[model samples]
Target: MKDETKYSQVWNLDKLYPDGSASTQFLDHISHIESKVFSLEEGLNFFNTPKEINHSSKVADLIDNIGCIRINLSQANSYITCLLAQNPQDQNAPTLKGKTSSISARFDAGLKKLQKILVKTDHHLWEDMLDTADLNPYKFILNEWRKKADMHLTDDEESLVSDLMVDGYHAWGQFYHSLIGSIKVNIQVDGERNELSVPQAINLRSHPNEEVRKESYYALEEIWEEKKEQFAKILNHIAGFRLQVYKKRKLENILEEPLMENRINEETLSAMWKVVSKNKQPFIKYLNRKANMYGHTKMKSYNFWAPIKNTNQKIKYEEAVNFILEHFSQFGTELENFSRQVFNNEWIEAEDRPNKSMAAFCASFPISGESRIFMTYGNRITNVLTLAHELGHAFHNHAMKSINGINRQYPMCIAETASTFSEMIILDASMEKAESGEEKLFLLDEKLKRSVMNFMNIHSRFLFEERFYEERKAGIVSSSRLNEIMHEAINEGYVGSFDNPSIHSWAWTPHYYITKSPFYNFPYTFGYIFSLCIYAKAKEKGKEFEKDYLALLRDSGSMSTEDLVMKHLGEDITSEAFWEKGIELCVRDVEEFITLTS
Candidate 1:
């Protein structure tokens, strides 16, 4: 008999739009966006003249008003993204998502016009404008505009780039996603043949059963191998479009744009990678320990994410929430209280269903000051951890609810700080209270897995992209070459720990295809170690650090990455020693795991 329990398995879309994509209210919102984009585009023409920056009072008001409108636009887009993630098969949702994409392009074109004016502003007047009531909150972004302004072409050319990007660059990313959604693999689970979405098969790579993991891995590779050429096209076209853009902008180094977007200098990035390179040995030791426990001299790539101790412990949904909240309360009531509200408010979609995305995300509605987390949950420990991670993002957004929308545009480097930090709070607390060696080892694997992922996995992604772009400069890279690059990246990244590597990972991963965030890689390591340093401080300072921590999250968008860290932690990001402190913390975890397992 089926259980009669009616769990809040799906999030409430009524608050966003009563009827999802078909909602009359949703159509009204889309129409409003179309109209607003037109009006904003026309009004942005006031800044066509370079001298307008010095004289126009309209610039400040326009900036504030446009920022306000962007919040509503984001709310609408968030709804569509949630809808699409829930049901990629929905024909109506795709059209609505495309409308949002078009609106986004027009919206970005208007911002470029505004950026051109800001670029041409006199330094003294720009400083004066930052002090104005209307634009004061947007100082950091305004300054960033002027600092990176030289890369821009003429205003019209810049606008054209944004417009063409709608169907040109971003469309490739959309294409990959659509393809992935339609893909399915046939496999046997529990003595029964089953059909699974690409995302579902990928998730099984973490399954505790070795046969299941191996079967899913081979099935995944076969499917991805079949479609390698099309995947290559997606990767090539996206990188090709970017390279051409950089060429037109006279950008010499491909990393220049990603570095600039991340609000970090080459030196800071180098320092982080330097520390990561030095710590690779420790991570490999942890990996070897994991392999030995599973009776393998060398682990396969599919087993990399498999939990140790042969455990497939299921953590119940409500139990996971209570477990997270119990640990979260140790830090402060506010975070705990906010998390509770999120749970009770049905702000999460955790239904375990086919055709749903495997990845988890926390999307904030800037206008409503709320956030919704999306994921495929199966009451597993991994699912609980993912819930905590997304909830951390939600809490971060909640912390900044009082700030203006424009001021909340933080870079990707600092974006994962809260989410990673939140995970640690639960992990550390759980480890401290574990009853058995196996239980502790299981938790140890969870912690060490993250360490290796950030230290090794993300580093490989960074290295792969760095090399890919460098080689791509010569010509379009063939599918075979992409595999070579991916194989090399994986081999070097894992330090030869795996016998059979997941080389086709290049096709299965979405981060490489994200057009907006070019280098969607290093920031994971940055946020990981950076938050380790923060977590260390919280340990030393106890509850005293919570207030400053929340304050830091609030100020994440309003300052340089270095300045933000210095203000809260008095650390210099450019220095190697600062990153070393955090990496050392990870090293110590590996050391403890070794001792415990021995």
Candidate 2:
């Protein structure tokens, strides 16, 4: 069976290059870039005048050098990542991780010098130069960073903060990652006891045996409860430090900073959630139906993802690839051809095995014009959906490849649209071919689960973050206060459907109080709702919208969230009506699923 599966395959990096010598060559190129970029720093004041900037075309030349350096460093890191995916405990893994960070720190330091020059120099000068060259790769790159030029501290202070943050805020994030990844749990599988990590235990919840699912849930609850206090301390310290830093920067609101960085506004966020909160009943109805199907009167948190009766169907690797290829072909030629290239070129890793990375990601290489997808794919229907999801991301990168490299940078909000849109494509198509009542019910349930996360769960996170900042402005928010905010947020968001109060608070989620990305939670909701709207438009407009869709993807690097939506959808992001429409779409799905299930 393994031999018959295309996704039972692993990547061969030797096809990229033979060995350490290749990495050494790449490192040497970065070294050369490090020396050359310093000259740009020295010549910064000359960039004040367009006439004087003719000396090696200042920003353009700097961008080209930086692009080359990025490609080289990225390729080296990717080569190591591919190797590490196969054997996570590989000795080279830690070394490669450290080396990547060190190399990134050095690159960041040099880039900070360029940023200082931007802050001190006449901003109009660079923007004028960038505007002239539609082809000059730095167009989007400079525009994005230029927006933040006003927020930067003095040159010395900015540099010092950049250095301190590497060790201070960023290191704490790494610490959380290490702690969560290493924690072990005891879950009963088939009446046998075994220790597993959180990721592994969560995976067991999808197992066929009901007992296994129940055991996995209790095991996670036990482990998280035991470590709850320590996790609380980490959250407190991180959030406390972040608020202190924000205050020093003269930022009055925590939401203000994250909103600014997200290229969005508070009005838009509130509008989106208002719609989600109003339509919450449909989601609650769907949950109750799902719970009844599993023979529970009211749903327990543990049973949220339990399979519907007789709905377990295996979707083989080859079948999943073909399904994606066929549905994507409906989109257009360029997309279809790209999917084929990914499959034929062995660009996907989908084998399920022990000691592999816990999850999946599709990383695109701007220079190589290639994307590699990493996931341990099993022979399940959801696995196929996951494949389609990641490929959506890959297809997005493929679309952006022709854009100037600098403008290819996309915001996280727009980033998930294409991926979720692809999942919709697959799920929608899969429903048409579903053979039985059970299959239809299962598919509908999965769709509803997505709606829950996108609308209800993510909205709760935003609510929590909003209140956390409101309170934090007064003084340092204690761990207990943090938990209270979290509980209040979840209660308001969920509205008592989830009855278990014991499991509802501060469940060791690191996002609740991360220092670097203070409001990391809301972006998921933003990305989901925003992308769903775009996807709905695509379905309505059909082939007529392809050119505009491609244009949107291409310009994603250059435009703000508000500007992009206005240009593409004719809807103002700040308008509550626009978000209500997106929320309505999710409510419609829940209604449709109920009709089908009942």
Candidate 3:
């Protein structure tokens, strides 16, 4: 029966596009946007004052049209990408990839022209037009633009910068992506031979066999070590490019660019991590005991995910769905019904297959007013957690469904809030229902493993990015220098207690220097702990808090992370108090695992 099920069985593309003509509609819509932008530009010339300008109405209409165009374009691109990922060797996939990129470039040029005109407009005039704009939806976006006045360059200069950005910054990311995806790992498991992709190889760390775990770790390191120099070159080039941009803007701190883009204050981030660092004693102790349980005197990177005991657990997909929906019902009717809708409506694509998109994510389409989940569910306990996590994202989008078009795009810092919160609920429920000591210990260890990876592993990478940019700005940081900096960051975070002979080899993972999202690591920890705080509230307040939680998700796109925390939880984000509280909640699970193991 398990073998009979396939990954393709879970995908429902009909919700995204009912027919093939949708691509034509999408092209026509974007073409019309290009035509209207010319008219909008001409109208701007007729107005002497921004207050007298009727640019608001036109801008609002344009924004809506653009949003629709994006959603449709994304749907088309995603469909093709998913198909291609399922079978890259498909002859039609190559043409689709080229066409997708060409379409994207054309759309990018149009946006650049519009941005050029907007940047040329007088600030006060633009403000007045924004205030007078009939569409309240665009007010937030326009205000954000004005806030970034310092970042604006001359129209031609900005266009040139944008053009350079694609080949320079973006291409670096593309290169790294291709490099990582092409790499394969071969590990010897007992008498058998095993081969896995990068993600799958990483997942093997959770396997119970100590030898298998060690073999997988060395296999990963071997592949990465072979590519280390070229990988370092890629990292250096990307960081160098970013530093040049920062230098051009005269930004004093390298972190300033991503902080601005994240719509967060540095004080808030520092405060959060400071509390996280201070609370590390509990996690350190937790790891020590967890290591002892696994019969290791000191934990190695290989044993980081080693199970605390035998679980022998399996969750069938249907049974997993029932468990998710049952726990969600405790939140309220909205979540309960939303889960049902997601499962019933072809919103999810959950099946494991060879050569599919390697991970899971939820994408919301504004025009279609729907969400699509993409994953290869293997009927593992972890797979169920993935579904619950993605559904949380979908629930977040559902909360924003009635909001204006421009406000739907949330900042990355808080993007994982809903998803992690969902994971907490599902995991907590499973722990509560565990029938044996070992089962409880296994669940508890899994949760702590997540916390450790987020704080120590991912956070260390973020620190490396910061230092890399700082050094790169002064001059190009050599490949050796990059690895040295990475080693220091890793030692500062993870190397303290672990007596592992081999280091984590942080240079091998490309996320540290990926240009797609610089400083990409800390947010996971933030979201992880932040969701814990929310989950705590949900547990205490019961169904009553669900409304507030939904409201929080709806406002996430429009507000700063600090404001979101303040508004939803009434916690001061620039202080250690809230973070301390969050860390205490994390330690509770650690404490429980200790008890379960004893």
Top lDDT hit: 1
- Highest TM-score: give the candidate number: 1
Task: Write down the TM-score of every candidate.
Answer: 0.92, 0.90, 0.90
Off by over 4 Å in 2: 3-8, 20-56, 122-131, 134-143, 208-211, 473-476, 501-507, 513-516
User: Model 1: which ten-residue window has the lowest total lDDT?
Assistant: 1-10
lDDT of 2 by residue, 359-437 (tens): 7888776657888888877777777788888988988898888865556667677788788888888888887788987
lDDT of 2 at 385: 85
Report the C-alpha lDDT of model 3 over 67-106, residue by residue, as the tens digit. 6555556555666665555556667656655665666665
* lDDT by candidate, in order shown: 0.84, 0.71, 0.73
Q: CA lDDT of 109 in candidate 2?
A: 63
Q: Which regions in candidate 1 have their CA more than 4 angstroms from the true location?
A: 1-9, 48-56, 131-134, 181-183, 223-226, 353-356
Q: What TM-score should be assigned to candidate 1?
A: 0.92
Write model 1 residue lDDT over 274-304, tens digit each, in one string. Answer: 9888779988888888788888887777788
Candidate scoring better on lDDT of 2 and 3: 3
